[model samples]
Target: MMASVNEYYQQMEKTGIPKRFTHVLPPNEIEYKNWLVGQNGLPPVEEWRDRMYAETVKLLKTMQDGCKDQWDDDYWTAVIESKGVESPTNGHSLFSRCS
Candidate 1:
């Protein structure tokens, strides 16, 4: 687990060893307007749909692979779907369904 790794790294640091993670992607946000229909909210946009999906999937699978032992399938799915993707339609969020 990451926490255990971090702990080990911390102990090593006391003796002057560096600790590192192989894969760490910074975070970004995706707007949900496109997923929603033209109601009271903003109109949908086409550009974001494919890109958002691709990016979301890539980030998710990468994280899942990296943290395979740290998280169960359901937990990893929850982390990605909740934080990364957006669904403006259906009056719900992609992360919600992922959970």
Candidate 2:
């Protein structure tokens, strides 16, 4: 029997290819950028932006994990408003308090 879509995605995740290529640019584009850097000895502007975004996401995840106890709606709402970003959860709580 053929695998379901979820199973296909799970198999892909197991290979770790998706994680390795999480950048918005295609693999060919990234390769070309690397070649350009090799020629000029300077990184592409988009490379720096991608690195900054990845670092910011890592930092935010660490902060969220560290403050799991404070993962209430009020905290998320305040954070979303402070960043001038819309709430991804549509104003709903993203996590439930652990007993």
**Highest TM-score scorer:** 2
Worst 10 residues of 2 by lDDT: 19-28
After the best TM-score superposition of candidate 1, give how far the Cα of residue 43 lies from its true spot, in angstroms.
Answer: 17
lDDT values, one for every candidate: 0.49, 0.57
**CA-only RMSD, every prediction:** 15.4, 12.8
- Predicted structure 2: lDDT: 0.57
TM-score for candidate 1, residues paired by index: 0.24
- Cα lDDT tens digits, model 1, 8-89, are 6786678664455312222222343443455557665545454556555666777843433322335434544575654343
Model 2: residues >4 Å from true position, as ranges? 1-70, 96-99
Clashing pairs in model 2, backbone N/Cα/C closer than 3 A: none
lDDT of 1 at 44: 59
